[model samples]
Target: MADEGRRDRCLAAHEAPPVPPEGPVTTRLPRRSFARSATEVAPELLGHILARRLPDGVVLRARIVETEAYDQNDPASHAYRGRTPRVRVMFGPPGHLYVYFTYGMHHCMNVVTGPVGTASAVLLRAAQPLEGMERMSIRRRTDRVRDLCRGPARLAQAFDVDRSLDGADLVRGSEIWIERGPGASAASIRRGPRVGIRVGTDLPWRFWIDGPWVSVSRPAAVLSPR
Candidate 1:
């Protein structure tokens, strides 16, 4: 497995720096595309590109591989307590970035979804690195392509995402925006309990491609049990 190989490499060269990617900027996903419920948006996000372009013209790109849905009424969501200073953007319209700092150490990003006044979003989990990986390596301090964005916090670091991007318009062609890229069919997507939480963990809102590399291991029960 790729992960096993990664373990071996890490044991051998855990301190080695990663090689960055070199490429042109890829297109961004349209703004209108995010006008859907968080549940409808999560699984569909797989294989799409989430990109960040620097002022120097270096474009960092990653293919979204995993996500988790957070609804207004979900007990596990930040907005479950109603809107506040930190979660205000999540209550806004769709297609905007809802970034937040977590653990006092790293940032995580989510795409605001659902109708206006609805506090729902899809947490971007893992992504497959595509462009400008050299810089990503510098930010993440690792050379493993799979390790670049194998988790949400790591994804933020790999793409230079942080609280400053909070409420940024994703559909507005800005420094950070999502662009249409490869996507999987519904059957190719899987769902399981959300990670790192006790409340609402059994909701099965987490979604990911079945075979692609992922940050988390597959849960024991696959939703719908194909």
Candidate 2:
């Protein structure tokens, strides 16, 4: 049976399927199509979950609450209009991960969306912990459930996500992927303009969980994507 399990995993890897966590990792939740191009994914990703399995058998999951979009031509985007050693992954075949550092302090994770060659991505904004609470609490240095996966960079640290995850194939990596959640209750998904950008503050691309301490920052403006 052990050998069979190994063989099964090898075959699954050969097929490039996501590495399921030990003991029934499938959340058995709703899955969505990558229908919105990357341009729209920025705000769309705000209510999703970003999950990763640790080597110690704990899986960390965060509910996305906030996100900012990046377009190739958008000066606010790192790549702007040209490719750099860092932003190349953003020019993707889709379903890939794009990680970068900000303020020299925190790492941010984004999902590449849209057709290849167009650098578009949805920034993960927030997540509510659905599994592995003990693990998340430890990483966050607090037992406060609300503080564990509250913000973009905090979510990354809570999962130990770093540059190593920069180009990881999100749809298939053992260490990273996004799973659909029950989602913030309909009344719980709060929409608003983005934070931290010097310009394009009117894009209304940020999303967050309403009425929960899980949100590290509130949308300065209350409105969904246009």
Candidate 3:
């Protein structure tokens, strides 16, 4: 209960802006954009909009604010041990959603990066609610708009993401896609160690925009201006 209270306080620290009348008019990122390494794609995803089209025709959108990179060679990556049934999608083509269940309760979403046959992905850590706030609020069980999509699990829950979305194509699929937005400036981007990983703890692969919407607390050693 103490942890829950702290989470609530952290979420309440930022006031959500008024919902925009309309979402930004932007184009979906091309498949080629995700063909590079996860480290390269992670930082670049900040400020982009992730759109989820529900079965009821309601579209939920969020601006990605935090991401962490993972490669098969990285000790912290699921695919580090080699190919397996669970990580087959990671070795597939780029620009696909790699949704996985964690802690037996939460589902985290990743964007497959790198070329075919390589296991590299970017974990979308947090996003700022954009379109469909009412739906997101209802799904998240919170009226505080800032709390709707503050963490990866929360973001997935708000968007109704689950194992069913695993391997969903983001570049060409209609259900889930990422659209270009006013990207975060390089100066505002910060890099630190990834969260909740026992291995690869020292690698500064986590990237996020310096903003209240970021999921985790600010790291003491922020390597930025890249």
Candidate 4:
């Protein structure tokens, strides 16, 4: 069919480019980085690179711009009521993905933090696409690069993340991982309350780098450099 042919061509055009012969020269973050509370890891994740590798050898890399922290003590956290089947990964070891479906149509991803048996995670809210723009555009259904991974759901979709990747280990996985990149300066980080949560509305656990790639536009308090 002509329509099918057009669709195939469109997809081919968006296919990721071949990887360099030498392979990706990036340093993966150590698991110890996530062996703390979510609030500690969330702001520090800003500016780090989150990379996803496709089966066909294409790698998509993005710089984290915004994140939200959640822990067992937080009323808005999934672990607040104690561990359940759906949130078991949050109580597992650190440096694992905690992908969850939300709103019946979208998938959001989080990085597990804290010691084993403790529930803590950082929600990756937004990122700036640094590579595989064409592939991400196809997945996100938008040609505008700025809109590709502007929110948690959009970020997951752009990276082809889903429930299947819920327990994937980021520190050791070949498919998806976080790499060390330039960190956001303390003075450049902003803190604010987590979004779209009915409870724990007053705790300023959300953090973001001052950048156009940030998902939300609300003003936040600036942190003084240490």
Q: Which candidate comes out best when scored by TM-score? A: 4
TM-score of 1: 0.84
Worst ten in a row by lDDT for model 4: 13-22
Runs in model 4 with CA error above 4 Å? 1-26
Off by over 4 Å in 1: 1-27, 220-226
Q: Ten consecutive residues with minimal summed lDDT in candidate 2? A: 27-36
TM-scores, one per candidate: 0.84, 0.78, 0.86, 0.88
What would the TM-score be for candidate 2 when compared with the true structure?
0.78
> Model 4, 1-226: lDDT tens per residue?
1255644542453343423222453478889999998989999999899999875768899999999999999999999999899999999999999988888899999999999999999999999999999999998889999899999999999998877677877876666789898988898899988898999999999999877788888869996664
Report the C-alpha lDDT of model 2 over 1-226, residue by residue, as the tens digit: 1255654543354357555654344542222334357555554555566778775657776666666676777767787858888898888667777888888788888888777788877777557777787888887799888877777777777777666567776655666777765544445455566677887676665655564644555535444335
lDDT of 1: 0.79
**lDDT digits (tens) for residues 55-81 of candidate 3:** 576999999999999999999999999
User: Residue 193 deviation, candidate 4, in Å?
Assistant: 0.8
Candidates sorted by lDDT, descending order?
4, 3, 1, 2
| Model 4 C-alpha lDDT versus the unseen true structure | 0.86
* Candidate 3 lowest-lDDT run of ten: 13-22
lDDT of 3 at 69: 99
Model 1, position 191, has a per-residue lDDT of 84
Q: After superposition, how far is residue 189 of candidate 4 from its true place, in Å?
A: 0.4
Q: Report the error of model 2 at residue 100, Å.
A: 0.8
Clashes of each: 9, 8, 0, 0
